[model samples]
Target chain A: MKIHNFNAGPSVLPKEVVKKSAQSIINFNGSGLSLLEISHRSIDFLEIIEKATFLIKRIMNLNDDYAILFLQGGATLQFSMVPYNLMNQEASYLDTGFWAHNAIKEAKKFGKVKVLFSGKNKNYTYISTNYHIPCDMDYFHCTSNNTIVGTQMKIFPRTSIPIVCDMSSDIFSRKLDFCQFGLIYASAQKNVSSAGMTIVIVKKNILGTIRKNIPSYMDYKIHIQNNSILNTPNVFSIYTSMLTLKWIENQGGLSFLEKNNQKKAKLLYDEIDQNNLFENKIHQENRSNMNVTFFLKEKNLEKEFNKMWKKENIVGLDGHRYLGGYRASIYNALPLESVQFLIEIMKEFERKFS
Target chain B: MKIHNFNAGPSVLPKEVVKKSAQSIINFNGSGLSLLEISHRSIDFLEIIEKATFLIKRIMNLNDDYAILFLQGGATLQFSMVPYNLMNQEASYLDTGFWAHNAIKEAKKFGKVKVLFSGKNKNYTYISTNYHIPCDMDYFHCTSNNTIVGTQMKIFPRTSIPIVCDMSSDIFSRKLDFCQFGLIYASAQKNVSSAGMTIVIVKKNILGTIRKNIPSYMDYKIHIQNNSILNTPNVFSIYTSMLTLKWIENQGGLSFLEKNNQKKAKLLYDEIDQNNLFENKIHQENRSNMNVTFFLKEKNLEKEFNKMWKKENIVGLDGHRYLGGYRASIYNALPLESVQFLIEIMKEFERKFS
Candidate 1:
């Protein structure tokens, strides 16, 4: 069966990336050793880490001021780590979705987290922009894309405070202004590659500000000093992410990915808007270009629609458990054909139901 | 060129485990979806988590009273979490090696950590047997295997205090009595798969004892309550580890691994002892079956010997930067043939050097 995955995360990856990653695990770079079994400190494995970091900078057009690091734990860990490292006195946050809320919760542990804006009133259906960025705050935190509610901050709010983004779902989908932010992090399973690595890009000058005695692993300065080799890293995950970055480069980098992403998102959203049987709840301006969420006119028809999609070998279309409906996450690696096929299925369903 | 990897960790993994893990990353279990691209909350991924936990329990013969958790942040993070959760007033530590020192450092932040015994006087050359484990301490902490110094505790010290172990390097290499310890954690890169996930086995009753308001991610109680899915986990690392565990099962379980490990370690150690050109520094009784550290008989020949080994495609044999010499790590997945080949090369080197 030809399955088209619509999973929000640990989500779709490039076929080439998958094939190459599989081969590398068996005999990485023809070393005749499994990628899983090599020391992270070995020259070969160091090359993997170096290449992964180098490519992130290359693809993102990040300057030397930015240091790219591959850390474990996940964006969730970063939720706490960010505050532990950066949030000394106060931090500003925009509560965009579940992830943002979690980040806020962690930040509160360090100091006062001023929630400048939140979409909680709309049940997290849209991005809240009515906010005042406090100058006194150390940094402004936001989730660039909401994976669950399917909304995104299309344009980042202007803030003098260092911008810290949890771009778990939307990183690499489009070109990012590395200069505008002090730090940016994303879990690899979404747009990068797999679930075992978290990519952290931090500006060099931001270290040593935290007054607390941060644990060595969580401390960005320690990781930076050691060159992200403080401990044995997820070698296979890093290698696979490197492969994904190479694939991205081959596909013409971020500019190319943005076009494809926009096209895929537009196709799905256009179908939902044009068809009377289906409707997208998120305002079009705030709708995520990555996760397109919608529901049929008859809410009870969700089960039938989900079953139909599954039969068509379309998986992971079900919305988050907290939010019932369908969410199709079109990350960078997800091909346009998969989105087109999904649209065809939606069209067929619309014709049948109408 | 064929490479012989003796990395401490991200160490060697079974070739079969690597191949299977790589395949799953592209199209998991014939689902036609990349494992990297799937949701951690998806039923498919949930099954991976469940099966991974179940397999660990079954293979280890763990009782139902212990909860096996797949956590992020590696064992370093666990150092803080363990003390945070278990230390009410004070804790006792056996300072055996680098890891033990790190654990104690983290524990100090939480509360008073009483050092029961330390090998620091001898530069951590041997595990200490003479120590008074304080009954007043909340728990006694120790590292089961020391990767850097190449030493293992021949017997766990008898103590009234609850035992907590960092079994990072030697987990799954032998059978363990789970009931003896309150908690045992191994970062999955060594004997399991990669370094993104930490396997934590904690007693259920130990929860809620700590006085501090632990961060949700750092709290064992919350992770246990949520079944280690407190947030999106390192899905790919866990899934690969599951494959490795399955491979272990196929290879006649822990007993088979133990026997193979002993045989492999003995071959290299015998070669080191009988040959005048090479010598192992640790006391034979305290030698680690996992990491076998050695040095050249003639100090001047060390660099030449390392270069010679590299030319033979035997990589990662160089000792840790802090401990200059050579360390051949014979992890579980390391083939007997690789060890035999290393012995052959060693014999050749000895004949030439002698």
Candidate 2:
């Protein structure tokens, strides 16, 4: 039975990508060596990373000004690395949700950090778009999507200072203007690849401006110079990412993915709004297309709602630990039929209850 | 046609480990989700990491004083992290080979570094155990095995100060007393599993003494607090490592592996000694049982030697780019039969030449 997986991260991968990844584990491109066993510097792996870099840049519509890197340490590492490399004295951050809060905390450890705007006061249901950017700061940072609250920034705040974004949850899900951001990083669990690797797209000229002598592993300039092969990378994750990218390209790139994602979100959100039993706290314009969070109106119906979903073969619909509600994360790999299936279950439960 | 793999790191894995890992990639223990597609916080992955942590400590004969962590960003990350978290004023390092040199370079960026001993002047043909370690230094660091030069420390140099070892290449190839080192870190590609994940074993008390506000990702204390679940780790690598660890245990643990590894090393070393066509560089006492590096007596036979090995379905024998020769890394999973096959080919080639 194919479970309709809606995991937020390390989440659903395309069936074809999973099949090919499994095959590569046994034998990578018929090299008589498992992809897991080969040297990262081998011709096969070098080509794999090269193609992955190309695909990421092409998908993002980025140019030579940006250097594409596949790194380990995930986005959590980037929390500190961003400040360690970019912040000279002070930086401004938009505190959106859980991950963005972490980015702010880590930045403060290195130097002065100014929280220009915060959604915490309102439970992070809405995006803070009308934020005042401090021109004196080295860079402005924000989380593109709040995974826990299912709120996303549809329009980025323009700032004279270099802009940084932690697009961990919604990086390749939509058309992103590459020119606006100085640095963009995303952990490859949600929409890109698997867990453990982070894709960093940075404008090359933005690095080396900080006077602090940064550690090589965390330094963007060093990684760019080495082409992200500073050490033996997470080869499996990068290769898996390559397969995912290939899958996305085959599905007709960002435009098609964006449309599909929006359609899925509309179907689920519309059901939640019309049905009295369910409630979506997020504002309609701010609701994430990738992660759609909802709760039961009566609160007592939570258990029965969960059982119904389980019976329908739904997985990862349980909300985050901090938030006790249901969240359906419909990433690029999630098919429209799965969303439709979830909608049908919701409507059936509503009808039965009424 | 399974080629005999001998790559130094990211090398051969046990047949069972590979099979089980491939299966998990498709469906993790019948969870209806690929291992690559599950959240790190999921119970399934949590259990996998717990088992892996337990097995590593148990295999090493470590007590609760030690903390075992599975992290992303390979041993290369450890180069800077060690100094950032451990070194306060000054540190000492043994100059062994390529990786050790890199470690020293990274450490200097944080504090004063002193080279306690250097094997470089002699082309790393011997391990230096006679050198004096400075007790006043913050910590003394060394590489347990020189992968490129095929030299292993038969006995570690005792130091009163904290002792850290980069055991990337020869971690589980033999049995050893684990009490001597304050910290032991190894990239999984060598003996543990695949690339992209690093295993760190540290004495819990050694942390918080430095007083530096270490980055969360680099801080051993933080990782220990989080049980190495501080961020999204390389899930695929850790799971695969757990499978390999189980395979190691089923093969009768480290004692059996030590005996098997020694026997394989002796078989090949004896051939190199007896056969006048090839010459081994390192002294007998310092010779590594994990990686056996050698060269042709005439150097002109290199092309023919490579071709002969290729015809026999032998792989990863090519030396490091910096060093031009051959390195056969017979990690724990490599069978005695493979070593015997390699010896047979060496003899046949010798006979043909004679």
Best by DockQ: 2
Candidate 2 residue-wise lDDT, B161-196, digit = tens: 989999999888788999889999999998988888
TM-score of each: 0.96, 0.98
Across residues A35-126, which tens digit of lDDT does each residue of candidate 1 receive? Answer: 77767777887888889889998998987898898888788889888988998889999988988998898888888989988888898888
Instruction: Output the TM-score of candidate 1.
Output: 0.96
Residue ranges of candidate 1 with Cα displaced over 4 Å: none
Worst lDDT run of 10 residues, candidate 1 chain A, spans A33-42
Q: In model 2, what is the error at residue B344, expressed in angstroms?
A: 2.1
Error of 1 at B284 (Å): 2.6
Model 1 residue pairs with clashes = A10-B36, A10-B37, A10-B38, A11-B37, A11-B38, A12-B37, A37-B11, A37-B12
Best by lDDT: 2
